[model samples]
Target: MKKIKLGNSELEVGEISLGCMRMNELSKKDAAEVIENALDCGVDLFDHADIYGGGESEEVFADAIGMNDDVREKMKLQTKCGIRKGFFDFSKDHILESVEGSLRRLKTDYVDTLLLHRPDALMEPEEVAEAFTELKESGKVRYFGVSNQNPMQMELLSKYLKDDLIINQLQLSLVHTPMIDAGFNVNMQNDPAIVRDSNVIEYCRLNDISIQAWSPFQHGMIEGPFIGNEAFPEVNAKLQELAEKKGVTDSAIATAWILRHPAHIQPVVGTMNKGRLQDIVKASDIELSRQEWYELYRAAGNDLP
Candidate 1:
């Protein structure tokens, strides 16, 4: 139920947001239930991408909720672009075209935020600046961000952008935590100490760019949830232990671990089941202590130098 300022913007959103990547798989009736339940659980932000469900997710979301002026005003909608069928495109024309498509599908006048889905090696910052300026001037996007970008990538984009980059979406969880692992094992000669993300956590914190954790419960790249998976028994046991102590589900404890970090990272949950959604939202209320947080971290088989 707690809200935080979203990056450098004036928007105050819930600590936990809903990720709509799999919403297209649900029926309109079921999707409606999911949306309604999310709002009831104090989630005010929804994240999407141009290619999710082959663009059917956005269409289904709008139709399921029977989107109206009132309904649109109550929640913050975020969508990402740049990734194409066979390549990444940050060209001005592609950026412009992508937002128009998203708007038409979402039935919204403007998205609360727009993000580059992933890094585009062929990106021209000048072209991106031009596209973003046009979108801002035309009232199609209110804020801008990037996903899976490192500090240098963001810095390069920031140099040409007229507006500040507000959010950087990344993968972070108990099992998939390279960003956090490198921080603890700094300067050590270990696999965990190999810095891959360029200290993005510290970069985001110092720059006030909110890091939105995309897979808080997943172990690998969309492999599956680790909460109840037999492969992750140690962490699951630790999660269960903490859940019982806090009177919440093991999933909630996992989510709370992400929220406990001082960086103020927000987790974008993608569960479609209303009951599971409610259980996960309980994470916003539970606060994990430093000792408990590290215990869960170590139980996940992560080594410290």
Candidate 2:
């Protein structure tokens, strides 16, 4: 697996990180096996959120890691907070409480990074900064980030916080790339495609904030699977062709297409299958040529100018 610096932090994480959302449903032994497989495959960063499986995911991960001392030292653990069951909370109390709960559940004291699960509309940046400060001072969290935030929201948080926002996790994939697609199809009046998050990719690249891509294989907002789906047959066909050419699996090709971008997006894969995890790490090595990258983009229904 390839390692890349996560934003400006001293920590360098695997280019392909494992998302542990589904582990909550797996048996403890099965979850441990899957995690061990990911480590053996060179994945060092593990992603999680507080709401995954009603907090069972973090507990399972804690159990899995606590069972193995050696594995605990070799991997970096990252989790998210700020998401409530029916609302959002970024108050200092909630932030501090969530981090402690996550730490107790993960069987670790310090998270390599703690990302705000999502943007809270009623967020007070000062309160979040206070919580982050307390966590950093107490050695509970080393880095800070956010998920599903636009550029303006990031700016607001940055204005009040002292620490560098290392990452801004976003929903991005070949079929769901309005951040990239909208820029190319500009000036098409009345076209919703022409109006998306205005230059979020450029903003992150300019600010040295790493982009973590969640749902990297989904065609859209959790509607259905993209790989081999009849709605995306053209894209899947091209993915298969490139996968064969690169000697990687079709899933790896799909992942590589995202990694090939200059923005340096890290794919947070949600697969619980150990074999699928191995295949995803292989994607870090399958470099797509410029034409191949564009071919997949076009296959996703974007017109070439």
Per-residue lDDT tens digits of candidate 2, residues 191-273? 53565676888899999999999999887787977998888889999998988888888899989999999888999999999
lDDT of 1 by residue, 221-285 (tens): 96988989999999999999999999999989999999999999999999889999999999999
* Candidate 2 residue-wise lDDT at 96: 91
TM-scores for every predicted model: 0.99, 0.96
- Backbone N/Cα/C clashes per model: 0, 0
What C-alpha root-mean-square deviation, in Å, does candidate 2 show against the real structure? 1.4
Can you give the lDDT of residue 31 in candidate 1?
A: 96
lDDT of each: 0.94, 0.88
- Candidate number of the best lDDT: 1
lDDT of 1 at 283: 93
